[model samples]
Structures are given as C-alpha cells and as structure tokens.
Target: MNIPKNHLWLWLPFVVVVCAGYFIIPSNTFVQELVAFGIMSLSISILSVFFKDWRIYSLVKVLGYVFLAFFAFVKLSFYNQYGVPISSSALYVIFETNSGEASDYLSNYFNGTTYLLLILLLWPIFFLLKGLFRKNKFQEKPLKRAFLYKLFLLLAALGCVFAIHKKFKTENIPYATLTTWDDYLTAKKQLKDALAIPTSKAFTKIESKDIPQTYVVVIGESTSRWHMQLYGYGRETNPKLTEIKEELVVMDSVITPHVHTITALEKILTLSNQENKAPSPNGSIIQLANMAGFTTYWLSNQKPVGLYESIPTIIGSAATHKRFMATDDYNYDIYDGALLPVLAEILKDKSASKKVIFVHLIGTHLRYEKRYPKMFEKFQTPSKDLKFQHEKAIIQTNRYDNAMLYNDYVIRALIEQLRRQDGYSYLAYFSDHGDEVYDTMDFLGHNEYHGTRPMFEVPLLFWFSEKYINEKGSIPKDIGNRKYSLIDFPHTFASLSTITFKGFDASKNVLDSTFVQRKRIIKDSLDYDKR
Candidate 1:
C-alpha cells in the first residue's frame, strides 16, 4: 500500500514514549508496558490509513495519550523517591503512612528526576498531536501478507500486557495504583497475623546478681563504620567520639547479622543465637531485662508509623515505659538530637532501683541531608575516595558523613550525660545494619539483593562511667578486638547486666572470658567470611 510519506513519521511519538518510559521508570515491567504501548501506536497509525471513521481513530489516539501521560507520572513520582519499581514493601510503607510522612519525603528528597520525567512527557505529546491534524487520503490496500503482518503487531501489543502480568502478578497495567492498595492490604494482614502468632517459652530460669544501676542499650540505624573516622575513615566524622576514646571501647571487628534494618534488629534484640537466629515471639532483650527485675524504658528518636507498628516498636513494647521522640511522620526522617531531652528525663528518674534504658536512634537512615543539622556539615570538600554512580553521589556521600558527624555528637552527649549521673552506668551502642554509600561500590543504600561487605559492617562501642569503671575495673582489652555479630547481644547484655538466665550463653558474649568465636553468618544462611 502506498501511504502518505508525511504520515510515516507518526511512529516518532511512540518512539519518544518508549524512550521516556525507559529512562524514567527503568524497570523490566515498565519496559514491557512501553513496548506494548508502542505496538498499539504503530497499529493505530497503520489502521488510520485503512479505516475512514476519523472520530473513532481520534478518540483512540486521545485515550492512548492520556493513559501514557498518567502512567508516566505515577512511575516518575515513585521512582524519583524510591529508585525502584513499585513493590509490596513500598506500598505498605507509603499508603499505610500518614500525611506528615508523605509530606516530609516529597519536600526533602525529590530531586532532578522530576524534571527529566517532565521533558520525556512533553516531547512525545508535541509530535503525537501534530500528526493527528494532518489530512490523509485513502491509501491503496497492501498485500494480504502486509495486512497479516500489521494484524500480528496488534496481537503482540496485547501480549505485552499478558507478559507484564505474568512477571508481576499483583501489578496492574496502565493503572499501577491498583497494585499499591492491593499489596498494602495483603501485607497489613500478613503482618498482623505474624504479630498474633504465639511461641513456646525460650527461657526456663532467670536471675540478676548485680547492684542497683542504670544500663543503657543504644540501637542505631543504617550506620556504616566505614563512614566514621573512629573506624579509620579519612574524614573527621567522629570528632566527639575521638575526644572520649579513653572511656569508650570500640569493637573494631563487629558486623551485624543482616544488612536490612528490621531483620538485623530482630536478631540483635532477641535471645536467638546461631541455632535460632530468627526473632522469637517468646524471647527478646527487653523481656530478659524485665525478667531480671530491671525496670525497662524504651526511648527513641525514630518516629512510629501511624497504626502500622514496626517490629522494633512491638519488641520495645515489652519495656515498662516507651517513648518515641521523632515527629517527622512516615517518610520524612528527623535528626537524632530530639532524643537527647528525653534521654535526660529518663536519666533523672530514680524511682527504679535497677533500670534498663533502650535508646533507638533514627541515625542516618536515608535522605542523608535531613538526618543532621546545618552545624554538623563538617565535610565540605568532596570526598576523594568516593566514585560516583548517580548524579547526586558526591552530595549524598558528603551528607552521609555529616550525618555520621552529628551522630557522633549525639552519642557522645549521651555518654557524657550518663557519666554525670550517680551509680554504676554501662552504655553499649551498635547500629541495626550498615549502609552502602560509594564505599567499595558506587551505590548509596542497602538492599537484600545487592549485599556488600560494608552493608553489614557496623560500629560497636561500649562506654563505662568513671564510678562503674572504678568499681567493676576497666573493660577487658580482649573485648576491643573480638569478632562478633549483634545476634549474640542478648547473651552479652545478660552477662553485662549480671543476669543468669537459662538461655544465656557465656561463649557468645565478647566481654566474657570464655567467649568463643563462631562463624559470622548473615542474611540467615550466608557466612559473612564467604560473602
């Protein structure tokens, strides 16, 4: 068939749409959708030549453009913030969240990707609308083979829709919002059930032999030791920590049991050893602390999500008292300094003869720029060690280091506050997991799929008050070099608190004289040494 030469360029708009979706979404399913849409555009252009009903053709063209633009906007909005395709985890974290969290995330983290998406959308719309107005004569019908070939294209276009559904069973094509709500409800139900399931007793006997004292267990989030000068990084990211080095015992070879937040914390805050590393409903550090007659207090800078309580919050609920200092809502992360005032209040409370204080910090989770205040941006010069993979890589690295710097200040202040207080005081600190920030790789976050050594390597430190040091003697030198995982924290905590429990394993405690070095396993089955 002889078609108008000018009309042949109608495919340009489809090509633009495909290219735009590729860059903006940058996922396999998204590419599949673009391919399917491209085929539809091609078929429509070809069909316009054979069919004389202009109204029907024009309506189809308008609807296609509208769908394309709407789909692109959704993908672009989510991709800019998450840097990944829409998934169940993201859906639960977003929709199950409050307006404050959503607001914080949009205000702080939305970057250059927003503008790039806009350009991609506008370019395609320009050519597609222009092509719609051109007058066309009835082109001569082509060979039967040509019509069959065009018809095959239409089927293939529809097949792309099937291919997408096959890959992502829950995700809806053209309208991805359907999956967001569906996955959210499904996940919420699963989480609810998981929390409801009961477990058998983990401990048979429990006892505490120590005098009245306040023991502080501080848990940090997404902090990599590689970014801290205390761990020998080039930057002055740990000035406060360096100043108080004599009182602190830095465990140099410590790594977390998992690379993700909830997974690592689950193991860290439970009596789950290597044989039973999964978090048990029957046992947790708080329960053990509570059993030993120590009044437990859970104070945190990490904001609690609306109604959707996190695993940490559930675990923290075992404490006699609980407080969350952060007010940033869901996606918007806040500074850890908000916890300082609350920590002061907890320290002043003398009603409990023996107390266990658990301090959880927001601690450099993500959106690094917002994790610290302006005064903490000490690393002004671009880091020479960092290699860029993303456009904001350098800036992100700088912000991360600054966050670490601020974290150092917060921790040091806590230590000083504990020191000033009367009686025996023991403070131990470790992050839930480390993060990847252009360390060995060009990435700047932690994920289960792309696990790295830096992602599990975290900072572990213990501080003793002058009075406690004088009474109990200095912390053992062996504790500094001990290679251990946070999974053994329950055993170590029991030992430090002078608690004798049935599940307590002396060999697992790094401070214990009988401490044994076991295989450091991460992500449940993989050995850290092998990984």
Candidate 2:
C-alpha cells in the first residue's frame, strides 16, 4: 500500500506551481485554479507511472510541470501588475492591441514587481529540471498493487470532476474563456446590427423642441443606497450630496431589475422592461437622444470592455462623441473626476443647441480602497450595525463607505459643472447595480444566485438647474417616496428631457404626472419588494 518516495516527489513541482498562483490570485478564483491544476497534476502523475522508461516518465512529468509553471508565472505576473488574474477583459485587450500599443503596455506594466513575481513563480521549473537530470530508474510495482494505485488515482480524479461539475461553466478558466469569447462575438454582432438600424428606424415619431438644453446621465457602478448617508445610512458616506439635499431629487425606493451590470444596464438604458423582456427594438436612450437632435456625448471612467462584451459599452457607442478615461479594467488610477474636463469641453460646445451627456463612474466597485484617493479614506471605523464584525468584513465595509464618500464628491462636481452651463440642465445619477458590503449579509459582492436586498437597492438621484426647474416645472414633493424601478428608467428619462416617441408610456415615467408604480421584478422572477 506504500508508494515509493521517488514517485511521491513527482507531485512536488506541481504543488509548487499551484502555490505560486494561490498566493497571487484572488480568493474568488482560488478554488477553481486549485481544483483544475490539482486534477491535471494527478492525471499526469498517473500517466507518468505507465511509462516503463525512466527518461520518458521524467520528461513527461517535467514537461507537465513546465507547461503549468509557465501559465502560473504569466498569471502571477498579470496579478502583480493589475491586482487581478488574467481575465477575458485582459485577453480582449491583448487581442485588440496593435504592435505599438502592445509595446506601450509591456513597457508600462513590466515593472520591477512583475519580474520579481515571475522569478518567484518560475522557481518551480528548477525543481522539475533537477528531477529530469537525476539518475533514477522507473521501478515496476506488483500487478495487483499497481492496478489498485491506478484505480485510486482514477477515482480521485473522477471525484474532483464530479464535485466541480456544476461550477465548471462559471469557475473553470477554459470554459469561462470560451464562453466569454462567444459572448463577446455575440455582443459584437448585436452591436453591429444595432448600429446598422438607422435612428429613424429604431424609434418612431421622435419629437423634440430642439431647445438649448443639456442633460447629463451619470451612471454609477456597484453603489448601494444602503451604505449612503443620503439614503439614511448611519455613516456620513455622502456628505457632499447631503449638503445639496434641497437641490436634489433623491429617490428613496429605487431598485435595479438585475444585480449584474450587463443585465441591469441593458434594461435601464433601453426600452426593455419586465413587461418586455426582449431586446428593445427602439434602441437605447442614447439613440433616442440622438434622434431628438441632441448632441450626445458618452464620458466614462470605466473601461470600454469588461469581462464580457459590456452592454453599457455597446449602448455608449451610440453617442455622438465618446471618451473613456480608463484604458483597461485594471487601470484604477483614473477616477470619476477625470471626466470633468471632457464634460466641460462638451458643455462649451456651441455647435449643438441641445446636448445629452452620459457620464459613467466606476463607483464603489470591488477593491473599494482603490476606487478612491488616499484622502477619501474617511471611514476607517466599522459601524456597530455591521452583520459581520470580522476584520476583513470591517475593512471592506469601511473601504466601500470611503468609496461612497468620494463618489459623493464626483457626483456633486458633475452637478455643479452642469449648473454652471447657461441652459436648462438636469443631471440624473444612478448605479447600474448595488454592492453587498456586509450590510445585511456577510457578503461583499453582488450575485444573482444569492440575491440580497442591498445587491439591488441602488441610489437614484436627480439634480436640476434653476433654468431646468423653471422650464420643466418643479419636481413633485412625493417623487422621492415613489416606489420605482430602473427598468422603466428610459421612459422617465425621456419624459424629463421632453423627448417623446411612438408607444411612449407616461405611466412608466416616474417624472410624469400619471406615473404609476409597477411590481419590481428582479432576475425576471422574484418580486424585489415582496422578497
């Protein structure tokens, strides 16, 4: 029943390779990489046992270790540079990069830390090389014992496979990469088709006054009303917004239709709603604004492409002009405030009588501490009401709140910029979806499978200039208390901008006098309020 020491040593190199990635990869992807690499190494070790020749067996084992070590080293280097593992978004960036751009990226990212991490990760290769050169003979085992050992290895491999079967679609790197590529292709096709359909064809009977007005749609990411002081959170996470509380229409009961960015934004930015689950034939709000004779501008701090083909990116492409501050997902240096100068230039444009600007902020996303500057690290102390009082949870919650505080500054700055413009202007700010930073649960991110209240409870705020208020009439006193869903946001946005098209529903618009509250459905199944 005992295995030879020489045979046992075969697993050492693989283990070392796995440990390299284990140290750098995030906790979420840890188990997937562990199981995947574990199964591979075990299978290879078993296969190596069949090689009667020592040289061939050593070669196979060493080759397997080297192959895995190479990938591990690459992954570790990427993680060291980006603070994230090699993702589909990173891959897409690579695929799209020209020779010049690739050189630039290499020069920028391949710092001393990258080389240091790579050197550490590739150290396992030396172990494999030493074993390859060692004078060892392949010892043949007894027939029964050999069969039993093979059976045990096979059973172990099968068990690992069975355990990870359900998660294979999402957790496995190969599956995720393939699916993500397919999704990107599909989304690219959809985007191409969408762009082909003329604005006149997408929306019927577009009517606009062609007035000298400016509308700014500021979209926030992973921000929750549950953590914001403006929404009654105990922490002062929204000091700037609170200061201008009288001037803003802070809707209290707004929830996103979905917990994920792509799902929520696809519905929020288009006519697709609970009643109409299909892709909106009427195009996005950007297209609608374009048809209304408004010069559209999409200014964003977020990367153009996320893990998959970003629906927001596809929607944002419909704008008359677009400017993305952050080049890649890992570029955390670009804050939301970077969009201010671009917006200022757009606001100064006298070329268009009316302008519709969309500002997308990377607000309160994961790695919350990186979402803001050092000065915004105000919420260091954990709150008493935190569900989980552990160190990690407390730190995450504090970082999220600090990110929210910085988000307050960015939103206020956008509002002020819009106010300075000499026109009827209004700025609407809302998160694509909310994050769960251990508020009501012991979770730090949003997931559709384990849906929570904080995951869908987004912040929807509106700031209007005096000219906008005088022209469009004052916001209703009861508007803040209205139970609304972002699924019907396009209608509300259209109503606010006075842009109407065929089949436009006044009942769905929260700003309209006849606005009616409908059941807030999330994930196309659960009623959010009822849940």
Candidate 3:
C-alpha cells in the first residue's frame, strides 16, 4: 500500500537522517572502517535496486552477487564488532581477509590481490548488466511520487558526498578543528612534545663494538592477554609456548598504551607521551634505535595502505637521522611466509651486526575465520549463519585461537631456528593491544574496550637463547615477574643490546633490578606509557 504524501516526507527524512547520523558520528573517529562500511552499505543497496534481474545466475553475474553478498556480510560483521563509524564499510575487505598474524600475511598476499581484483571485475560486469540488459517496461510518464523519491535520494547522495569530501579533505583531518591561534599553538606544541622526548634514553653510543646482540621484538595484533595460557588465562590458546615453560618468560601484566592501532602502535614505536615526547620531526623509536647503533625493521601484517598504519609505515620507510639506522620496511600483507623467505635470506647471509626486527603479527585478529587458512579452522564451528551472537562469537574466537596456535608454532620455530644461529640472538613477542574476545563484557574484538586494561593488556614474552644466556649474562634474572608496556621497549632494547644511548628513561626499565619504584599509576590515563 502506498503511504500518504505527507507521511512519505516524514519517513524519507527519517531514513536520510538515520543514514547520515550512523555514518557521520563514528566515522569521525574510525574513518577507514566507517568509510568501508558506508561503501558496503551503498554498494549492497544499490545492487539490490539495480541488479535484481532474472539473469543473476550467470557466472559473471554470480560473481557480482558474490561481491554484494560477501562485502555485506563482512561489513556487517565489522559493524557488529567495532560499532559502525558514521557506518563505514571500507575496512570490509580487511574484515573478510586475514588479520593480525604477523608472519602468515605475506603468504596471503596474492590471494588477497586476486580477491580484490575479482571484486573490481565483478562490479564492472554488474554495471554492464544493469546498463545494457535492464528492461524499462513502464513506458508511461513518470509518476510525481517516483520523481520525488529520486530527488530525495539524489539529495541524500549529495549529502553523503559532501560529508565524505569533508572527511577526506587534507585540511580537515587531525588538524581540522584547529580554527584559532590557540588551537594551532596547542596542536603545534603537542606535535613538538610528542617528537622531542625520548621513549628510551641511553647513556650514549660511544662504547666500542662488542658481541652483536640482535633483538627482534614481535608485536602481535588484537591478542588478548586473557586468552593465552602463558598469561595465566585458563584456555590453552598457546600450546606450543606452554610446553616450553623454562625458556620463555611471559609477563601476564603487560598493558598497552592505547586500544586503537593508530594510538597504541604509534606510541609503542615512539615510546613518548605528552610529558616526555617532544614533538620532533623523527619517529621516536626509530630515532632512538638508530642512535643506539641498531638497524630497525618493521614487518607488519597490517596493511600499510590504510589509515591505522600509514603514519607508522611512512616513518619506518623514511631514512633515520641517527646513525646507520634505516626503518627498512617490509609489507606484512604479503603473507607471513613471504617474510620468512626474506628472513631466511637475511639470516642466510648473517651480514648485519645488531638487528632489531619488529615483526608485527596479525595475531588472533578477528572476524577470525579469515586469519587461518581453511585447514586450520577444523575447530571452528560448522555454522554459516552468523546472526546468533553467542555461537558466532565462540566460533570466531575458536578460529582466532587456532590461528594463535599456528602463531605459537611459528614463534617456536623462530625460537628453535634462532637457536641454530651462530651469534648472540634474542626474540621477544608482545602485542600492540588485546582483544575483548567475548570474555570481558562480552565484546567481540579490540577498539571497543578503549582505555581499559583488558584492551591494553597483552602477553609479553622475553627469550634469551641458551647461547645468549651462556654467553652474555643469565637473561637478566630480574627481567622476570615484572609488569611492562611498549613504553619500556626502547629502554629494554638499549639495555639488552648494551647500546649506551642518551635521552632514554633508563630508570623505568621493566628489567631493572630495582624496578619496583613507581608513582601513582593511573588506569586509562592518557599517559599510560610516557609518564
């Protein structure tokens, strides 16, 4: 039944308002995810309207249908996990694809590329099918109501375009709200402060070269500290590490500075907060590591092209102003195994003196089903319907755990593999932040639990190979049973590599023999790490 004309106005405006509000509000914070979701929404609804034809059974047509269905499903899943940002679905591809497995991402690259290409190709076919094959059976003059609907939709489209332009416009982001001189000064000071302070200060790199100790700090993604058995969690999420209790030291109380990648990882790499972090032009960690005579490498499973990682990736790619240090970059999206080939190459030559490899794994990241190849998901529930909340969460969590199991295997392999190396070698694995994983407040993933300990808490492990312990010291016995954050990483590296670098907060070492001295440590404070 047709609605009354006046009623249509109310309902239509209501629809538009909801459409704008849901997509606009949250997109302000999580622009990428929200944009992806928005695209998925626009694409799916547009497809339904334009491609509901009889010939959708063709292979190309089936592909178009697949594009619509898959993007919608993934986009909906992300919205369910991280609340819709102005309702963006741009990260929909990210959701449907694998995440947080640092090493495995390299292997998944070609597949991801193929999938993206297929999506692009399918869209054109869909457009062609709509434009060429669509039959306009209504030959009569267009009804006023239909015209009005089109006009309203056009207006809505214009609104969406304007909002998007405003969001993406270079002048609007991160610095957009600074409308006054005071705002500019505040932002400038923040930038200067964040850059100037050292995340890890050292004595100075004047000492003569000793036995080179290469420390690889691997940061896992979305890995909840609570899920791992090593972190004193009840679950056997880390079977490989659990069996080898003697070699690894897991710091159960390790917390993150932030929950979102942009916030957490940036601080981790820089290790500076408002008080200490002077807004210098260089990235904090990269700058410090170079000064300490260590080459820094950031191999990430996270996509470098996106917003969450763009800043860090660029910093890692840039030439460091300090000593012979370059943030030699490796795109982690190309499957973790692909990086292995590179690692094998790096180790095969054994040319570098002291190396610091930042292997950022997409560890136990979610939607969970996509992280592990199908073979590893045998433990995942055999259910396609994702509407049931509990079942879906359990299934996805299980899948994520299985992926963790795989990472545990890889880590163990790296451990054992490094043991074969002829030099003093060390490997440490921690996470950027933790996931909620249906355990805390029954949330599905990270970013939702912003500023909470569970969101920041991660499994931190330090390993000094028997060779290192037998050679250098006893893996610093005091390093055990201490709470730490990414804030301490640069200092810890300086201590381990024996690099006497200046401008570091050496007094706050997690491994310090007298590290118990701390002031009132506030929870969820903006200075979780820097202070």
RMSD of each candidate relative to the true structure: 6.9, 8.1, 10.9
Q: Write model 2 residue lDDT over 1-531, tens digit each, in one string.
A: 444466655565456546755676678877776766566556656666656555676677677656555655565676655455566654543454334335435643466766765676566666666666675433333323467777887787676566545654443444456767787677667655674232636688989886788899989988999999998898888888899899888899999998877778878988777777665454788889888888888888877654224667777877888888887554345577778888888888899889899888888876577788899888788788798999978888888888899999989988888878857989999999998788776666765655778988889988888987888689876778889999999888898888899878889887778988889898877788777
* Predicted structure with the largest TM-score when compared to the true one: 2
lDDT for model 1: 0.71
Each model's lDDT comes to 0.71, 0.75, 0.52
Off by over 4 Å in 3: 1-210, 274-278, 306-309, 319-335, 381-389, 448-453, 476-479, 516-531
Question: Tens digits of per-residue lDDT for model 1 on 1-531?
Answer: 555454445554456556655665557667655655555455456555444355444445555565556555565566555556555545444554456545645555455766666666666556556545653453233323366776775676566556555653434333345666675566445434433222225655888865778888989988999888998998889999999887788999999987766667767887555676443434777877777788888897776663337666767766788787776653564888888888888888878889889999888877677788888777766787776645467788888898899999999988888888867888999998888888877666776556777888899999987777787678776568888888888888888888877756889888878999989987678888876
Q: Give the poorly placed runs of model 1, Cα more than 4 Å off.
A: 1-200, 271-280, 329-333, 384-394, 466-473
- The prediction achieving the highest lDDT against the true structure is 2
List the candidate numbers ranked by TM-score, top first: 2, 1, 3
Candidate with the larger TM-score of 1 and 3:
1
Residues 336-378, candidate 3: write the lDDT tens digits: 4344555544555556676666676656665355556555554
Q: How close is candidate 3 to the true structure, as a TM-score?
A: 0.60
- Write down the TM-score of every candidate: 0.71, 0.72, 0.60
What clash pairs does model 2 have? none
